[model samples]
Target: MGRWEPNARMRLVRAAIDLCAEQGYEATTVAQVVERAGLTKATFFRHFPDKREVLFAGQEEHAALLTAGIGAAPEGVAPLDAVAAGLDALAASFSPEQHEFSARLTAAVAASPELQERDALKTVGLAAAMTAALADRGVPDPTSRLAAELGVLAVKQGFAAWADGDRDDAGALAGEMRTALESLRRAAATLG
Candidate 1:
């Protein structure tokens, strides 16, 4: 835990989650997080604006991945299919180490209303990113929004299942997400 260690951002995130889980999100402070990370306040600020943000540091990156994935879809691809590609990209960014982190994060968020609100906002932000990406591809209004919603739902459901299931099988998050998306599609079809 040197001052200039690599993966400083991840260190801070893990420290924050650990502290929040041990104590409470409301009880945790930036000072404690930085201290736990063996990093300075400046380093903490460099990675996150505040303690709350440490829990959500990947928001923008995840959005970017989703946007790029959707944008990279083949021309004339269906909206949901584009969303699936985006989800795949997002899921690919996760690593096995993140499995425990995700489980801790879920518990931390569940225990705190503030963290829950931030988590909800994160979901909305991701959905909006997907919606905008789909719209850019000439998808119409409700369709774009609906597909985005489905993508978010898939991500949530998939992540929960992955986090709760066997850690050794954590790599199945992407498949779980895709499965959720397909299930949603099938359920929607039944409405027709």
Candidate 2:
């Protein structure tokens, strides 16, 4: 293997996703993934701790984006609005190239109980990140938690819609997430 390979992380991720989709997540191994990517074990370990983490490589970066987006929001804006800003930040990180990968990751998780549990943990982690950011902004306790939940839901719903919708749609992931967040906001308003 070459000492320096560009896009090694992405190549490993794509190879893992393709292998998982082809075989099964449980049946797939780190060795197989590395082999498929034509990268050495050292390179794979440098990028991911294991095969499962390949699917969740963006978790930390995503949480940081959420926190940063909320922190950057104008002071005294509503909590949900702050969350919307966070979602915008998170969505902006995605590219058209990732659309297919998102779809495949969703499917791979759906097919495996282990991946589903990991995905759930990811959701909780994301919510915690958003909640902490909101708290730092002086959002009240229950309100911060509530807003975080809504933000997470919006991300999931919006991601699903974007991944499953027409690839040619003019609207991007940000638009879908904004729509989902607005829908949640409207629903919450109806409760009062």
Lowest summed-lDDT stretch of 10 residues in model 1? Answer: 164-173
Any residue pairs clashing in model 1, and if so which? none
Q: What clash count goes with each model?
A: 0, 0
**How does residue 153 of candidate 1 score in lDDT?**
95
Q: Give the TM-scores of the predictions, in the order they appear.
A: 0.95, 0.94
For 32-124, candidate 1 gives per-residue lDDT tens digits of: 998998999999888778789999888999999999999999999999999999988998898887887888999999999988999999999
Report how far off residue 182 is in candidate 2 (Å).
Answer: 1.0
Please write out the lDDT profile of model 2 over residues 1-192, one tens digit for every residue: 453678889888998999998998999999998888888899999988888999888999999999999999999899999999999999988877678777888899999999999999999999999999999999999999999999999999999999887662424888898999999999989998
Best by TM-score: 1
Clashes of 2: 0
